[model samples]
Target: MLIPYTVKPRPDTGLINSKLGIWLFLASEVMLFGALFSSYILLRVNSVDWPVGSTILSVPIAAFNTVVLISSSITVIMAWASLKMGNLSKGRMYILITFLLGLTFMCVKAYEYNTKFHHGLFPSESTFMAIYFTLTGLHGLHVLGGMIVFAYFWGPGAKMWKTEPEHFTNRIEIVGLYWHFVDLVWIFLFPVLYLL
Candidate 1:
């Protein structure tokens, strides 16, 4: 059976089903990441020797990835706006741009990881390394997950736009919210893990 409130807002709650679902999902994600951040802070503060993040990591590369993610955030929002404006092709183009930007961020991260491995800086090398890998690796997986969703909407999922344009737009909006959160996490991570 077709789901009610997929596109329309519910009477009890002003959000459509997917919008409400994404917000709830994001709340849980906040807790998951919050626990990790809290643990990292406690560990670092307790340790006698914590390496300066900039000394151990490539700030320039991380900064570049930051720009890429921020750009993707903008593009994803633009994609939603384009769809809302009834421009399917334009929206799809923006979505493709966002996907590629995410890909770029992952590739840069892979390069950074390879460089670390080349220098023999494995997680076992130090506490800083361990947390660094854990945080970035987890964040990378989130980025990859968003890419998978974007890919679906850009490819086979585009078919929905033909018959159910409004529904398709709502789907894009929900995905955009998730994408923005991923970007925001990196914004926090960049300074915490790289600068500090």
Candidate 2:
């Protein structure tokens, strides 16, 4: 038997099962990050000397990563849109681009981490470094996770396009929501952890 409300919205909730599930997941994610952000603020406010973000972090690198993430957000949307428009090949191209952009962002983050480690800076070095690493590291992990999901849809999961087009599109839409949330978090983090 087939599941109800997988593609169509449930009358009471106005969202499909996958969309509702993603929003609930994102809500919990928001709470987790909010608590961490509040802790960062409390730590900074109570500290005697919080290192200036620009002096400690590479602003240029972080800014570039920001662009990369924003680009991925656009590409993921395009991928979903392409699928909705009944263009499987185009959708595949957009998803591939999104994955590559995510990979690029990760590489840049790795480089930034390597530079800091080479300079003998670590999360344990100071309160400022600790908060910085904690926030950005968590965000990076989210990016990695999104990439893996997109990669799956791009590869083996693409078969769903022929077998269950609406379900496949819904999957992409759900993943796109998660990807946009990840990108949005980085948008907030870039300034808080790198520019400020």
Candidate 3:
């Protein structure tokens, strides 16, 4: 006698295990980021001389990236809405746009990091530079991860708009959650690190 397995796709449960698992994952991510931010606050209060961020960081560039990231959130929403309406092509188009925005985020981030290094804002500069690098680098890695997810979602091999539309919808929602978190963090970072 052998145990039987049910591998049938479960669309009835509303995107099956994807959304549930993604939410759990997102919750963990929130806690992880929360710790980082808390550490930033604690260390900031301890430092007598914080690195001057305004002279080092380019607010114009970062502000532009913020807009791009926020716009990607809109793109993901459009994709999800289109999928709900059974418009697979439109959904896929919006998903592709989201991926482009994610790519733009990475490109601009890489350029900014390079500029910081050129200005002698290395890890050894001060405690502030260390915090800056760690926070922004973590955020950049999240952007990279989003790009990876979007690459799979938008790829022809994924059959996103064809065979597994519900699965695609779940993927979009998870990506959207991650995108919104990224944008929210940047909102605080921009004013604190760039403006203040």
Candidate 4:
């Protein structure tokens, strides 16, 4: 059986099925991250001797990651815009750049993690380290998931643009929304975990 409203908006909700689904998912995500942020605040506030973030983390590396994520976010938007303007080749190029930027961010993060491990800075080393690892690790997982989806769309999924152009463009836009969220989370994290 064919599902209704996969691409077109529903009369009552004015949202296609996938668009509505992503928004609902993002709402739940907000709550989940909100709780984690609240916990971080409480933990930091109650600690008797909280180590400064700059002292424990490499600010320069994180700043570089911040730039990477920000650049990826820009590319994602450009990819969607190119698709909307009926430029499939341009869209693909922008998305490839976005994917490469995401890969760069993950590589830098892995290097940072390796450095921390070599220095005996495991999560169990301190309260700040535990929260830091938990928050950044979870965020990294989101980035990985986004990249997988982007990769699929960039490769085999490109076939959809030939058959169902509108749906394919919508899919790219929806993924862009998700990519923006991931970038925003990293923007918040870079400062909170690296600067102060």
Candidate 5:
């Protein structure tokens, strides 16, 4: 005869609750980007040219992308909460939703970049284009990287999400923190690059 046993997590699993740890890491990331934006602001304020996007990018499109990124952040939270409640299936679906929104945001960003470059606003032409591309390009790569990570966890460990909820929630929490950081960076970038 054979019997099944329920395994308990090691006591040391509490070493650093993934949620809290990721939050701390994300906080540090926030400070890092804050410094970069402050530099961009100082550079912008001292420039002689006030007109940035004059005939280059579309304001409405950037605004739409902002809304999408913010909405994705909400979906990520919902996914984490769903996992917290032990609904692994719902959590997985929301994770996929968040991934889709992230992809959509990147697509929109690519389009905006294409439009700008097509109009002869190459980085070499001016410092504005240089800083603009540097900041936004780095931010876009982070978004794309997070999406890759999300896809990885979504496929492999999804089943563990149900039977081993602790680890599942931990993974989602880390990804959520990174996703939120990406969105937070954009929140500031949108104003600097598009609004003012």
Candidate 6:
């Protein structure tokens, strides 16, 4: 038997199963990140000495990653739009671009972490470093997760398009929503962890 609301909207919610599921999932994610952010704020406010973020973190590198993430967000939307417009090849290309941008962001973050380690700056060294690592590291994992999904949809998952184009397009839209959220989180992180 076919799954209900896999393609068609549920009359009561006007959303497919996946769409509603993603939004709900994102709400939980917001709470998770919100708690971490709140903890960071409390820690910083109560601490006797707090270093200015820009003085410790590399603004240029963080700025570059911000651009990369924002660009990936655009590319993800373009991928969904391409599929919606019946352009499979273009959709695949955009998905590939989005994946590469995410990969670039991760690599840059890894390099930054390496540089910090080389200088003996670790999470244990200070509360600031601890929260910085916690925030960015978690966000990095989310980016990696999105990249994995993008890779799948760009490769084997593309077969779905041939058999169920609308369903595949809807899947792309769902992924785009998640990708946009991930990017939005980074936009908040860039200033909070790197400039504040």
Tell me each candidate's TM-score: 0.99, 0.97, 0.86, 0.97, 0.84, 0.98
lDDT of 5 by residue, 77-158 (tens): 9999998888878888999998899899999989888887788888887777888898888899989998897787678868
Name the top TM-score candidate. Answer: 1
Q: Please, what are the lDDT tens digits per residue for candidate 6 over residues 1-196?
A: 7778979999999989999999999999999999999999999999999998999889999999999999999999999999989999999999999999999999999999999999999999999999999999999999999999999999999999989999999989999999999999999999898887
lDDT, candidate 4, 118-153, per-residue tens: 999999999999999999999999999999998998
RMSD vs true structure, all candidates: 0.7, 1.1, 3.9, 1.0, 5.2, 0.9
Mind giving the per-residue lDDT tens digits that candidate 2 earns over 3-89? Answer: 689888999999898898999999999999999999999998999988789998888888889999999999999999999999999
Order the numbered candidates by lDDT, best leading.
1, 6, 2, 4, 5, 3
Clashing pairs in 1: none
Off by over 4 Å in 4: none
Could you give candidate 1's per-residue lDDT for residues 1-196 as a string of tens digits? Answer: 8878987799899889999899999999999899999989999999999988999999999999999999999999999999999999999999999999999999999999999999999999999999999999999999999999999999999999999999999999999999999999999999999999
| Backbone clashes, candidate 4 | 0
Candidate 3 lowest-lDDT run of ten: 1-10
- Please identify model 2 stretches exceeding 4 Å from their true place: 1-3
Count clashing pairs, candidate 2: 0
- What is the lDDT for 77 in model 6? 90
Residue ranges of candidate 1 with Cα displaced over 4 Å: none
**Candidate maximizing lDDT:** 1
Model 6 stretches with alpha carbons more than 4 Å out: none
Given candidate 4, what's the lDDT at residue 8? 85
Candidate 4: which pairs clash? none
Q: What TM-score does candidate 5 reach?
A: 0.84
Q: What is the lDDT of residue 35 in candidate 1?
A: 92
